[model samples]
Target: KSKNPPFMQWTDEKIAALAPNDSTERRGRTLASSAKWNTIATNYEAIWGECKGSGSQPYLVQIKLSGPKYKCSCPVRKPPCKHVLGLFFLFAKSSAVFKYQAPTEALKNWLDQQSTSTVSSASKTLAPVLKTEEAIEQAKLAKQKRWAQRVQLMTSGMDELELWLTDLIRQGIANTDIQKASFWNQVAAKMVDAKLPRISTYLKETHLLIQQNQNWSEVVVARLGALYLWAESFKKRNLLSAEMQEELYQSLGKIIKKADILAQHPSSKDLWFVLGKKEGVDIEGRSFRKIWLQGQKTKQQALILDYAFGSMGYEQQYIVGDLLDGALVYYSKAYPQRAIFESFESAKIYEKTTLNTYKDLNSMLTSYGKALVQNPWLFSFPVGLSNLKAFVNDKKELQIKDVKDRIIPLSNLKEAIIWKILAISGGHSVSLFGEWSGLHFEPLSMLTEDGILSFT
Candidate 1:
């Protein structure tokens, strides 16, 4: 049997998952044709290829199987550019095409450099620092000063936002020209300047809802109500619980550094199953990925959110349905869900078995209601229901119906994906997992007797 690692055995779906966006995935697919490569070779440790590109010389592409790291001579700023992806796609299709050979001198040099850098970085990270008592005190005071300044800025921003909402309400939603982009952009820009990016996103989302949905007035009113509630809560934040205070800070776009979270928060170790993922590009042109994981023994759900800017990819890659042994440290929140890996061990295919799912839609909804009571600003909640049937409603929208005949609409899904789910179900009940946005359910994956199929 071959000794290649699990990641070396790449599949089309896996390749697509690594892409930063749909457009990049498409471009990679286009470049996957074997004829585009002048050479394809592999060793136990790495895969190397030379692909024909716009440049005069064939771009040299090398992938270190251990890091699954990519190195391409192409000028593209984005990692795992088309050349690297194309090489992997070709290798996945026919590994026999890649002759086993020693690395070329240039490839050897790149590999050696990567090894050296990895070791040096690890050493620096593991090294401890000695800080004098005075130095520590100075740092603590500086942090407090920074926090006080931020509080002042955020307070002013919230006051301005409250006044804007009041004016908008007085003028009335019907009278407002919501169609104009500036109606939302101007306020969103102000929020950004105040370092309240999360609030800015809410305004932008509200604008999009008005443009896309037919019953937008209700949506807008509900959103505005939430904003008003948050504003009122901020005024009384001093009386809130520590968890609620953290939630408020996050809502105002304050980020707790990963190192701080790892140092301060408790870590839970468990066999975690990669449930599914969602990817999208934000208004700033940065790509974001949300991967949902469920702990097998603890039955706890955690979200791993990662983002990448122009030409960069996410720091980590998670394949749906894989089970990993890891410890996660969750950020402080009223209803903690987002987490980062504190430690990671082995990963393997999740053994198909019974999953912890809600008995029905009512059970899931009740649980969600409780969570909402804890974190009023919760955007989306993960849910899994067993024996749910997928079907299209009269309005040509996809929905999942429970045994009670109660149904919830699936949000923002393509017709093709909807039909695929229907075909998989064959009019029979199937286990479904997804996120519930108070208004609708978005099916991300489905479980079958055979295995789990990802719909993301």
Candidate 2:
């Protein structure tokens, strides 16, 4: 999907229906074949309505098949989208041809012989668990090997290029250097030859920016982050989560066209802090961290950047939510879709200090205040509607929840839960379990090298 250009006929909306509800735009991508679907009798065709977006063209793509597998690219995340349905409609009537030929008697006979011989030779009588484990191990090994090879090929070339560029900088390319367009053009050409398309594209973009960009440092920083991300992706392709993998691919795709959002300041004058820096870490890919710390008449607040990481031609810096991070982060509304500030260290401020422990208003501001000397303005700020507790009325006043002490910032829900849990444990430590999230509780015991806690 990333390989395809802007003019490519496919769009995100077309991917929706054919995918599972839990499936994401870049996930749940089994892409089963006709034979594969024959085993499960899968595939379904469903349609919703006309397109709804900023576009003017009447674009339509839907599921065209179901039961024997399907394909669609709508935003729904359900499989067998309307396009796949329509495609299969032709298939059901024997009109359209598949990517592969139909099973022939000759081919079937050969396959049968091969299957028989393979089964006999391989000993299919192995225990299911052992067989499954062996298959998984083999798959892991194969994937590791493939990623290793790709990383080896891409990184070495990029490293050489980075060093070469650094040398040019040392020799002062700004003053005098090679003038031939063929110099960089040839480098870009070599990247394609090496199959390092990401690096190749980066070189081409950098050359263009140097030749045409009004702001070179900003462009360089943004592209540098993306190139670093692609290199990191090559390094850890086997370990990336589906969401992270999708993000890596998305960043790589935008390396040629996007800008670094970290350098772009919002119109509002607010103190933003660095919660996480992707330049030094691999988890957030090629992004950086900046948290907006706004202030009210009485206290300060934090609004996560949850970087609107889409479409803007720049480097994006994402912020963290108060409560979600690490494993539990996988479960939430915007879930799997998280920003940089969402890191544990960046978002959490759980202190065993005291109730309303903030000494003064200035001290209460986020770490951003010390550097920017501004505040998180509550009166006129870009607040999100997702926070149910912070919903605004027609009069523009915050709706207060009876359960909360005063009108709590909607962003404090998750943070409040963590504080509540900490209060219960008196900030020592507590073992979390299914019961904590509402489940039948039973006696439990936890042990560490220092001590043990037993529930009776």
Candidate 3:
């Protein structure tokens, strides 16, 4: 097979895209220019090499082109560390250096291990479905009993939380001092013990906001009210609609597993345009990557999340700006936004032309408010608007103005990048996409006639 295959060419631009940062890209370019690799070999699925690094022995480097996974016997910690990037750059610019041969023994062994690991994972996934009907019934009863115990614990935690909030309000939030982190940490620990981990997380994040934000008194109080409202709602959950109850339970940390989502939910097919990708590390040190996608035909948005533990890298199965013809099963929620892919008919590089956008600020906010009503615990909601202009306001803060001149402050944007976005627009209105976090809009990407420029 051709190393630089027809559909997937490992060109210089593609290699540049793969590099994690500009520093890494520059280093890879320098290494490739110096011809650092001593031996380079390629197979249909992989590229292997021995790079003469600044060490006694040459470093062994292997790239699983299919997995787009990189492994190098070097001290570098990041994925596709300098060596792998240089190898890819060489493969792209001068394929003549790589011998078209079968994989070496080491490479073969690694490939075999990867295959075995995948098979083992697939087998483990089937275990949940193997329970007999009687066993499933028993499990269900056991789960219900455990849930009852959790509810009792949670009630106690909520009672304590209510008293704490009442005390804080009575003392006045302006007079309160939250500098002691334990004020939040202790309550978060209690919630965790109560099996209300999601609530615990909300409290922890609120503590961060209290430290960082100037208007934190109002923000924290509002969030506390929302939390207390959710807790109270849970007390009368049976009176709520099925969708609302599902949303409540999910926000309370009742997770539906992958197998259940795949097996039970109905699938909806669309040509999904990936809008943006964000990667984050949680307090528990787990790595999470979320890809936001919007259907061209359906005009609906979906979020796909991938997670990894320590030292493990998430497999990036999709890329931004690509169109996937896929069927996705939606997770149960009042506002269904997250989904798991069920099947894909095909995928291709798609050129975006028109954006599904609101005509005015009122239109967008109305929709967002409706979604919040459906699920008050919603973190961020998507907003797309056309003929939107971005500029710095009097306070030097980035803001987006619609045709009607109604504007919202843009949060989380660097001042320099805001200028760049203005340059990209060239003083004219453009299509904009962002997330509304109750107070301000965090711009994700801007669409021009040429392409999408991601802010994340």
Best by TM-score: 1
Report the lDDT of model 1 for residue 81. Answer: 80
Residue-wise C-alpha lDDT for candidate 3, range 1-456, written one tens digit per residue: 555442345557656756666787888877774367788887756778888977789999888765356789998765667788888888888766666888867789998776444311311354446778899999999999998897788778778777777777787776444557787888889888887888888888888767766777767777878877877887788899998888887888877887777777888888888786666776545688777888888888998877876665444455555566778878964678888776552244444545678888889889988887777778768777888877777987677788999886556567666887788887788887777777777777778775676665
lDDT of 1 by residue, 1-456 (tens): 355544435677777766656777778777677788888888767888888878689998888764457778887776668778888777777777777888878788888876555321211344567999999999999999999998888888899999999998998899443568788889999988877888998888888867766777777888899899888988899999988988988867898878778778888888888887888777666688889998888888999988876666666667776677778878865687999887553344444444678878899889999998888878879988887877777987777888787876557677777888989999898888889887778888888875678887
* Per-residue alpha-carbon lDDT of candidate 2 for residues 235-339, written as tens digits (9 for 90 to 100): 675685664554454433323111122223122222232112111111223332223332222122343322323222122212221111111111111122122
What TM-scores do the predictions have? 0.83, 0.27, 0.81
Q: Point out where model 1 deviates above 4 Å.
A: 1-9, 21-46, 49-60, 64-67, 73-75, 97-131, 166-179, 343-350, 353-355
- What number of clashing residue pairs does each candidate have, in the order they appear? 1, 54, 0
Residue 92 miss distance in model 3 (angstroms): 5.2
- Model 1 C-alpha RMSD vs. true structure (Å) is 4.0
TM-score quality measure for candidate 3: 0.81
